[model samples]
Target: MEYILLIILGFFAGTIGSLVGLGGGIIIVPALLFLSAGSSLFTGINPQVAVGTSLIVIIFTGLSSTLTYMKKKMTDYKSGLIFFIGSGPGSIIGAYVNKEFNLASFSLWFGIFMIFVSIVLFLKDKIKPLNQSSSGIARTYTDEKGQVHTYSFQPVIGILIAFAVGFFGGLFGIGGGSLMVPAMIIFFVFPPHVAVATSMLIIFLSSITSSVTHIIFGNINWLYALALIPGAWYGGKAGALLNMRLESKTVVNLLRLVLILVGARLIYQGLL
Candidate 1:
């Protein structure tokens, strides 16, 4: 029964996360916490352990979704690589810091992060145009639909934001997609499909260091992770397909709604 519930949760997490460009950690961590609160099997589960487990599960979730995106030629490889490079060291640093901190405070602070993410998602449309005026390296990419998107971004700025995403991702046990996807769209003027696809790729790379550090710190739950994997894998494929069908504006609106709901839940949990 517990395994069944975890799998269901994982499915939802993967579907929602992939749709929004997150690595599913945001959904997984919170759901785990909620489940643990009432179940004997997960009773007294440490928040850090939940975060670590979520991160581990995200490895598979990210990979599954990224492959679909790759097939669609939706990813921006250069930008993804840039973000990955910056995120690597930042993830390691953030993981170490997370391990060193008190779990209670960290869980509460995660609520704050969620709230901030909600605000960012809400304001992204208004913000994207403001950031597009600055010119840097130009990029032209063709999607699976054969439509070409041409744009430019400030590489240094994007790298810096990626670093910050890595830090928060490690600290909060999220894939950083909640922050990174919107940041790319708003700050770098990346097309929505490109942002989501590229964010997933970068997340897969960045999570490597953070997951390793969490393993060293003994924070993972292998049984739960294993249970979650199949559901997440299947769900990711579903989400990737949906991503192609949805309009960019519709995706943004959906993302905003999810972020706000998740943020509120985290805030309420932290208050308790």
Candidate 2:
């Protein structure tokens, strides 16, 4: 029954992850919290175990989704690689910090970040593109088609953002998709679809690096982690397909609502 529940949760999380490029952590964390409340199977180190396990499952999820995006030529590898370079070191540092620090700080930061994500989604339309604007920070990148893509900041700035996001990924056991997607959209002016695809690609590399760090640090629980894989795989595939049918705004709004609810729940849990 526990395995069944994990699979189902993984399926749902993967589907949502693929659709929104969240890499499954946002959904997985909340589900685990809810499941732990009722199930005796999840106790002691299970929460930490679950996090490590989710990261492992995300490795596969990221790869599969990234491949699909690559097939469609929606992934921007150059930028993704650059982001990965910085994120790798950041993830290692974050993992070490998580091992040493109390998780309450992480929970608080996670809540704040979620709130910020909600606000960004709420103000999606009001934000204008930074093209020829001199005041706002913007950067331009040319694609294979010679299309000059202008964003709110330069690539160097993006590296810094990726480092911060990667650190969060290590601390929270997420693949950094939640933060990356929004960053790409708001700061880089990437279209929603493009951002979603690119975010998955970025998550893939970050998760791989972070998972390795966790493994080296001996923080992962294999049996529990294994339980979540099957569901995440199927769910992730479904989510990638769903991206084609749903509107980006709809997905973003849905995720924002989920984040808000999760953030509130985390705060409540912390206070308790």
Best by TM-score: 1
TM-score per prediction, in order, is 0.93, 0.86
lDDT per residue as tens, model 1, 119-162: 88777667644345446767777766778877777777778888
The lDDT leader among the candidates is: 1
Candidate 1 accuracy as lDDT: 0.82
Off by over 4 Å in 1: 100-104, 128-135, 143-147
Model 1 sits at a Cα RMSD from the real structure of: 1.9
lDDT string for model 2 (186-220, tens) is 76677676778778888888888888878887767
lDDT of 2 at 20: 86
Global lDDT of each candidate: 0.82, 0.74
Q: State, as a TM-score between 0 and 1, how close model 1 is to the true structure.
A: 0.93
**Model 2: colliding residue pairs:** 15-235, 137-152, 138-152
